[model samples]
Target: MNDVSFLPHARLDDLIQLLLTQGFRVIGPRVRAGVIAYDTIDAATQLPWGWRDAQAPGRYRLEQTAGSRCFAWANGAQAIKPFLFAPREPLWQARRAAGCFEVQELVPPPRPLAFLGVRACDLAALAIHDRHFLGGLHPDPYYAARGEEMLLIAVNCTHPADTCFCAATGDGPQAAAGFDLALTELDDGFVAQAGSQEGRELMQALVLAPATPEQRAAASQAIGLAAAAQTRRLPAPERLRRLYQRLDHSRWEDVGARCLSCGNCTQVCPTCFCHREQDVPALEGEATVHERQWDSCFSAGHAWLHGYQVRPEIRQRYRQWLTHKLAGWQAQFGRSGCVGCGRCISWCPVGIDLTEEVEVLLAEAADGA
Candidate 1:
């Protein structure tokens, strides 16, 4: 741990201004369409000041807080994934020529961004994405280019949403690493600590005072209480493999029936990265545009093969998503796909909870064994 400093709550916007002065686009939590989501901001006044959110399975509502706290909400439907791996991007375009077609790969717009109010679970998800995209056998040039230079200013979650379970997964309430700067908001101000050279330089520019021992203790206490407050948890890590044994179990059919196959879970999932490519040809047959768009397992065409679909049933689709997220992902990626953010639970229109489904399967597998 590095030396900590005190950033007064009233001057929190100073950090935003500082980032902007350094030629960085600042993106922070803001209220839009009645929910808190990360959006671009030019000044601190745009942040969701004095706002908090209430979330549950298939439900979400926003309310005003009593004080002028900037980040009372735990999370919203959006995460930092959208910034790194965008929803829609043009891959390449082809134009007809005399005897051949000319193809060119499209480059993403260049912009260095600073993310604000990011939580620990979201940080964990970003790490998983980094491993999958940057550390893979074939590195993704698109992700590598966009994710390379951004600054991550993370916030240690002091308020855990009811649906949150990052503590159980050992991923959240407080971020231990993978951030340039981490913040713990207290009543009077924020206890800010730098994790990288950039963070240190930024803090020095702000000319903040060193945090007193008492303030540090208060920050620690705030994080501890947030961890203790989490009510949801995944099953034991060793027991997660049991999910594979119960693929044929009846629980999948039950959940599938209620699932609308709307793909809301994947949309809101912080770690999900499924996508498909499309080609748009010109009416004159002179040019064709190739674009990549986000896709989900719940979609009917996701499993299409050579004139056939692999998963034709909704139960099978649901099972594929669950099995991959909890069990198969570990085998393929050396880590669990889920970070326990609980966005999937809250955003699902039918209120499907992966944690509850895992419990049922584990119990059934235990009885059968």
Candidate 2:
């Protein structure tokens, strides 16, 4: 941990302006359509300054929020996987003119990026995905390039939705790692801290001033306040794992009766990294290209193969997804894939709260016994 640089309240925008001067396309959240979503911005005017969101099972909506609400918005429908893995992308191009087939490996887009206003839960999710994609049997070249060549500016959550469960897992409202820089919006200014080398460089280049002892204390207290304000909390991690092992089809069916397999839960989830692939013909008369797109297990075709779908039954798919997220992920990556960002809960059109679901399962299991 390097000595973090800080600046007076007035020099805040200068930090963003500084990143732009360095040729990085900085992205943060702003009000768009009916909600706040991440996008490119040049100044504070474009961000969701005093706004926040209301999320629940099968629902998500933004409300004119109060306070120094830089992260007033809770969770967005989109996550980092789409940008890192791309919903759909060509893997390679090929041509079979007369007899022999020719192929060319795809080179992904070169976009040096810096993500701002990111929450700690999202950071945890990214770490889980990184473990699967980069530390697994096969590494994705395209995802690796984007992930490896970017900066993370995490924001400690000042507001959490009713669905957030990160605190239950000891992940955060405050980020202790994986960020180049972390920012906490203050009433009079912002509190910035450097957790990595790149973060130190960012602060130095921006020429921000050193944080006062007061600012540091405020930042720490603010983070604790946010966590204490959470509305949802998961059971013990060991209990969560046992809950999965005790799954029963009848109870799952009752839950599945409400789940439309619309995939909003998985879609908004920051760590759900499953995806499908495809191939397309090039504009020229002689070539074809391979593609990779984001996939969700809840989708009907996700389990499909040559003749039959692997987990054709909806009940099976639902159970598999829940089990993998809460249990198998720990074994596979030594971390729970869920970061408790609550995107799944808030974004679901029908408001299917996962915490409630887990509790229901536990209750039913106990009653059955």
Q: Which has the greatest TM-score? A: 1
Angstrom error of the Cα, residue 284, model 2: value is 7.3
What's the CA error at residue 45 for candidate 2, in Å?
2.0
Question: Compared with the true structure, what per-residue lDDT tens digits does model 2 show for residues 195-308?
Answer: 888888878777777778888888788889888888787766566667665666466887777777888778778888888877777677677878887789999898888888
- For model 1, how does the per-residue alpha-carbon lDDT over 1-369 read when each residue is reduced to its tens digit? 345899998778899988998888888998999889899998878987788888888988899877667877789998989988989988889998998999998867667889988999999999999988888589887888787669999999988788999999989889989999998988778999998989998888888899989999999998999899988889766678678888789888899899999999999999999999999899998999999899999999999999899999999999999988888888877778888899999999888888888888888566546
Query: Looking at candidate 2, what is the lDDT of residue 261?
Result: 84
Measured over all alpha carbons after superposition, the RMSD of each candidate to the real structure, in angstroms, is 1.5, 2.4
- State the C-alpha lDDT per candidate: 0.88, 0.77
**Superposed model 2: Cα runs more than 4 Å off:** 1-5, 65-68, 282-285, 364-369
Steric overlap count per candidate: 0, 11
Top candidate, metric lDDT = 1
